[model samples]
Target: MTDQSDKLFTARLADLVSLCERDGTYEFSSFLDERQCADAEQWCKTNTGSLRYRLWGGYENARRRMLAVYPDYCEEYVEGDYPFVCLTFTYRREDKLTHRDFLGTFMGMQLRREVIGDIVVGEGIAQAFVTEVAAKLITTTVSKIGRVGVKITDSKAFELEDAQKFMDISGTVASLRLDCTVGLAAHLSREKAAVLIRSEKVDVNHHTVSSVSHELKEGDVLSVRGCGRFILSGINGSTKKGRIHINLRKYI
Candidate 1:
């Protein structure tokens, strides 16, 4: 059932992309706002499988665009406003990027407003609606303030607790890395890291990594699919390229 839905969404997305490329009838260049969503929804209801329209952008910009397209839709959104909304604005950098690239770039894009959680990667690359994108963006944004895992060599259990408290960890483990720095840091055994790898909990280069010994290189994205992602800065110790050091930011 999931597979069928995925395929359907992909097919629909392809059709939309084709429409954008062929006739520009959907006005891909224009920002889609709340009003646009309402208008689009009405049109979709009547047209059935007609290009599924959605708006994506930062909140205010998206709102403005939507209002311009469908003022009444904005009223509905305003009346029942939730803290989160799914909408994205297409930018010049995103114009030629693929869905995967879009996700990675979105993860790295700057947010000028306060969104309280790390953005989850959009579940469906093909049929990604504004909400899904917003969710991911929010999750990623939250990660900045989140805690990352670090191992301090020779640190006692009590010290570890102190470290965790110092970090102010909450529910989820926001980031993970094999800390090679020489200071009071949390450390994960190769065995534990391997378990994460075997469980399909780790991703490198935007793909799931199953090998625990997957050598951490400089500038690699150590993304633990569902867990979080960290940018691996170069090893900071004694070596030609320095020690194997990883830099992590919490994925919200």
Candidate 2:
């Protein structure tokens, strides 16, 4: 039974990849309606493969339906009244080519603010997906990605407040300026920055540097391990003693 299931799953993945490549894109988002989910879940049950299809749509609609049907599947909710959702599925394959192809297609489409929830493939798939996404997102030869401080087990952990903090340090930063006052001004309040840096979650130039107070100079690339990376341009000037102004470039 297990062997048959595995064979079916592999074949399906191959079909999916072929469909994507032939069309230059594949979109399952539009096909997710209440009725479609019922059909899919029912179809998945009789199937032996580890791979299964699921639906995502308006938050309440998708959640209510998914939980009622696949109660054993892990779920987490994001706050807000909006119906936005990110649907996903899991496939067990020792190889990573399929996962990379799937992610690459979505990223290639460049949908703005498109949320691709963490894909929980096997360890090998997870590693490959990260590498593929990183390479695709980089524009310049030296692009910086920031970190999210917290390791999220579920999607609900991704909060708006946490996102705002990450932007303050890395997102909205324009440049990494140098100069005494510039450095001081660039210095973000340790308390606010510490939430991320203290966790030893933030990385500078690919090395984990937890010190929020760590002075950054021009041409320094700050990488927040999980969130993303930033390039330090240079400090604009000093607002006052012990306070310098700096800027950082956003990569993602």
Candidate 3:
């Protein structure tokens, strides 16, 4: 079932690319979740050259992004000029709005999920990236999110900084199993890590891997639901106890 889904997704993306090639025009896809983005990137590796595609979500650090495919001649197009519009939502200074809050509110608006990209929560404000049409619709229709009244406006001038947070960690694992690597990166017991994997709370490269014994390799990204996200940097060497020494960069 998973392979079929992946093939379908690849086909859909290829269709979009074909459209761009046929018309000699830039083509943009709807917002893709993390898994979809990873899949699309993998597809690009063997199928299309990097210059033919780009990804953007109105910011340098975005979990969800849209794929833009165009002819090789259109390489000069700036990513910022993509069809995404940033909407800034402001509420009372004392009111606390989280990423989840903003996302839930937008989802409540009954808009298509693909039309929404990323929602970034900042101090007393939150920014959302959506299709141009969704931005215009949201400004007029969205007035409140739960009890907090919100004022929405275009944030075209808002400057996004590179604010991705990560911490480097080093540890030794008995093996390269998913549970072992997750335990080391999250500082949890092996039993707990196995439980998380069994309960479907672990993802590798954005795809859920429920097997605790799944082997992990270098450059793999692991996301534990409650723990956090981490990248398997590399296996340095083996410890005296035969455990593998590894490095991980955990995203805060």
Candidate 2 to truth, TM: 0.28
User: What's model 2's lDDT at 37?
Assistant: 45
Task: Supply candidate 3's per-residue lDDT for 218.
Answer: 96
Best by TM-score: 3
TM-score of each: 0.34, 0.28, 0.82
lDDT by residue (tens digit), candidate 2, 1-252: 256854664455456434544554321322222333444455556642433334543332221222011122312322221223332222334433344454554465563322343332332222111222333332222111121111212123222211211233322232232122122234544354565676776656545565555666676666554546666665566554644466566543
Between 1 and 3, whose lDDT is larger? 3
The global C-alpha lDDT for each of the candidates, from Candidate 1 onward, is 0.37, 0.38, 0.84
Query: After aligning candidate 1 to the native by TM-score, how far in Å is the CA of 203 from where it should be?
Result: 2.6
Candidate 1, superposed: residue stretches over 4 Å from native? 1-6, 25-186, 213-217, 225-228, 240-243
**Which residue pairs in model 3 clash with each other?**
none
| Cα lDDT for residue 44, candidate 2 | 53
Q: What is the TM-score (0 to 1) of candidate 3?
A: 0.82
